[model samples]
Target: MTSYPMHTVDTAPAEARTPLTVLRETFGFVPGAAAVMANSPVLLNTFFSAFGHFRGGTFTPAERQVLLLSNAVANASEWAVAFHTLEALADGVAPEVVDAVRRGARPGDPRMAALSGLTVAFIEKRGHLGEADVKAFTAAGFGEGQLFEVVAGVAISAMANYTANVAGPPLEPAVEPHAWTAGTGAGA
Candidate 1:
């Protein structure tokens, strides 16, 4: 397998430096996946742009975490799974809900379940959702617009997840405790 550098702000390419710096300042450190993504300024910036839009979208922090975690599990990205696991817990998603998402099972909370279900379906089906998929998401109180927002979340996660899969960055310390193995999850 090919290896990629885990770049720091000082070591990243010129265009990637600014975003790495901002990420470091915001998170107190650059995440492992982002570090690897710094290999390409375009990839890093694109991920950051989509991430910014997703954060500004309609989902609550917990709901966003649910969708992100679902995407991670569905993509079978170990680094993403661990990162999203910690973020999900920190964002106040219930432990059981996080676990359920990690296991690729429906979450216990109605709203989270709906979010996770649609997100997993979105990924597993490659955006070719059935009518019931759309209805289930709407019935959970999410609007059609929010369904599109989930698309944004899935897209954002896809970039990160695919990056991690390809680069195989080491897990950051903060997320290490929540580390995952690809086939360990029930979904695998």
Candidate 2:
């Protein structure tokens, strides 16, 4: 069977919408991705909006691109890694930077390298972090606030990553070309 139910928008089943409505409306059709997330659309919406906020406010356009795309690559999320990495490149991050992030490397930023390293550790350790990890991050110039931002980044991507895996949402029109290959280490 097809991964997602394919029907005319008007023909889809009625699903509950708790704030994912804005997203459903934004897309003009509710794919299984959103419908499944409707169980806790607030979680998904919060994740999406938070990512938007961070993209706009916390990190520089280039830095945000690096943190995000690299994280997605680390998680091996093909869909997210593809889109954000491209968005990063389109937003003026160097091709070399994009290339680095796509390969799940540190993109040559000490701060991002520290953050990404912590992120990989936290994920691999399932959140059991060492004092040295936090200290190393701070020593590298990431403050408590940066740590918070990193957590937010991880949370938001965790939502998208899980949703994408479960719903297997077809890549959005804007991101199809950047789609990830299965078992790739981009999101690992």
Candidate 3:
């Protein structure tokens, strides 16, 4: 197993310190994933930069969380599952919806279900969606451009999922209550 270092603002490499500080400020404490990622300045910066772009895109916070949660579930990332569950609810995704995602089921709300379903399929298909795949997403009221945005969201979340799963970051205190374990539905 790869052992990843969890760095804080003071301990992170020089290029990563500023972002670690920002993460500490934003989350009141830097998340374990960010802390582990801080060991690599390029990874830390690139992930956050992409995350920022994804956030600035058209998806609402709840929708964004849905995409993230779906990615976490698909990737079998327990840490991200816990974190995104909290973020989903904070962003106004219903408890049931988040729970459903954690359980690897599609969310109940039609729109959120569509979003989550599409995200899962995108990962499962490795981004090569057929016309029918595009139709299902668009029929759910997402624009064609938003399909591309969903890909962006998937990419952003996938990084966290892959990192946390590989590096095994300890859960942050705030996320302890929502801690998750990957089930049979998750990937390797």
Candidate 4:
């Protein structure tokens, strides 16, 4: 079903994959998607490296998860939301936070609400938010740095999501069971 064969380290090309080490070091297992992206590890590592750089910044880890979920929900990617939502909950976000995000209420939690608002504006405006929107989110207390991280989150998701859609990669055996109810590719 996947455009590229779902591959393990043994199947993926050997030399191109600093991402293999990057993912293994970060998550303790090389992610299936990372292995697939290893066809051109440049593609995988470019985004992964950008994520590592953003992740090293000022926002709390919880805030990062919020931004991740906001983008996933906006893309209507249940596959994305499912994995990231579990990560959010593990980081102590309430289940209501996920539910609120799904229903488009900005999720009530402050960090996530900011993320949700930013995500909605970015998607709806196609990345052209007005000055007032920036003022409003800044009013809500997300600093300029976190705002940038949110943008980075969207960028990373955009890359992985379109790849996954066209690839139709089978959900990783681990992430499979967490699939959520909304997505562009549901049952397709």
Candidate 5:
């Protein structure tokens, strides 16, 4: 198996150092996956850029977690699943809702179900959303603009998810309790 270094802010490449430091300060610690991704300045920067845009998008924090967790599960990315599970819970998404998404099922909450359903379809269908998909999303009270926001969330999650799958970073202790295994979840 390939191994990757977990870089610290000071240890990261010059171009990656600032972002690493910022992430550390923002989250109170750098996520393990991001630490590994710091090996490639371009990859780390791209993640940061896309992530920044997604955070600034229209979704509330809980809604964003729903989309991101669904993306992680659809991509079968264990690390991202765990990380986003923690974030989802911290962001006040219902525990049942988080559990449902972690299990690759729709949430009991209608709005969350819509977000998860659309995000999974976005990844699973590779952006070829059918008319029914758009209709379901909009019918759930999401606007057409938020459909595009889901695209942004998916893009950000893909960067993190794909990196974690390839690099296999160790899970941070805070997220370890939520550790996931691909195929353990229904459609994961």
Candidate 6:
């Protein structure tokens, strides 16, 4: 396995320190996955900016979690899944909804199911979403603009998911209860 440095604001490069601090302040701590990415200031900055954009977009907190959790699951990223699962639950997404996404199934709610399905297809298709996919997504009552919103969410989720998979960032204790493996049925 390739080892990546897990950075703290004090130890991170000048450019990375600010973002790491922002992450720590906003999230109450810097996520390990973000810290690992801090090895490259550019990568860390890009991740932070894209994540900020997604957070500032139109999706509700629950919708954002669905996309991110689905992305983590699609990438088979244990660490990202755990982080997202905790955030999703805290955001008041139903436990069943998070569970279904962890299990690679859609949420019971039709609208959520559509969002999850769109995220899966978007990831699996590698952003070459077709008209049919768009039609189905829109049929779920999301607007065409939200499709673009999904794109932004996917970008952030993909970065986090791939980073966690590649670096195996340690799960924070707060999220340990939700720690997950790719196929082990959520967490222990």
Return the clash pairs for model 5, or none.
none
> Tens digit of lDDT per residue, candidate 3, span 23-132?
88988999888888888899999998998898899999999998998999899898898888878888999988887888888777888888998999999999888888
Across 30-67, the per-residue lDDT of candidate 2 in tens digits comes to 54445555555465467657766776655667766666
Instruction: List, residue by residue over 35-140, the lDDT tens digit for candidate 1.
Output: 9999999999999988998899889999999999999999999989999898988899999998888987898788889899999999889999999999998998
Candidate 1: C-alpha lDDT: 0.89
TM, every model: 0.96, 0.70, 0.94, 0.85, 0.96, 0.95
lDDT of 4 by residue, 1-188 (tens): 56686555566666545667767676666655566677776778787888888788776777777777777777776556666766677777777876677555677767567667887788778889899778777878878776676677789877665566556555556566556656432321
Worst 10 residues of 3 by lDDT: 179-188
Per-residue alpha-carbon lDDT of candidate 6 for residues 120-183, written as tens digits (9 for 90 to 100) = 9998999898899999899999999999899888888877788889899888888789988787
- RMSD of model 2, in Å? 4.3
Q: After superposition, how far is residue 121 of candidate 6 from its true place, in Å?
A: 0.2
Listed per model in order, the count of residue pairs whose N, CA or C atoms clash below 3 Å is 0, 10, 0, 0, 0, 0
**What's model 4's overall lDDT?**
0.69
Model 3 stretches with alpha carbons more than 4 Å out: 184-188
Q: How does candidate 2 score on lDDT?
A: 0.64
Worst 10 residues of 4 by lDDT: 179-188
Q: Judging by lDDT against the true structure, name the best candidate.
A: 5
In model 4, which residue pairs have backbone atoms overlapping below 3 Å?
none
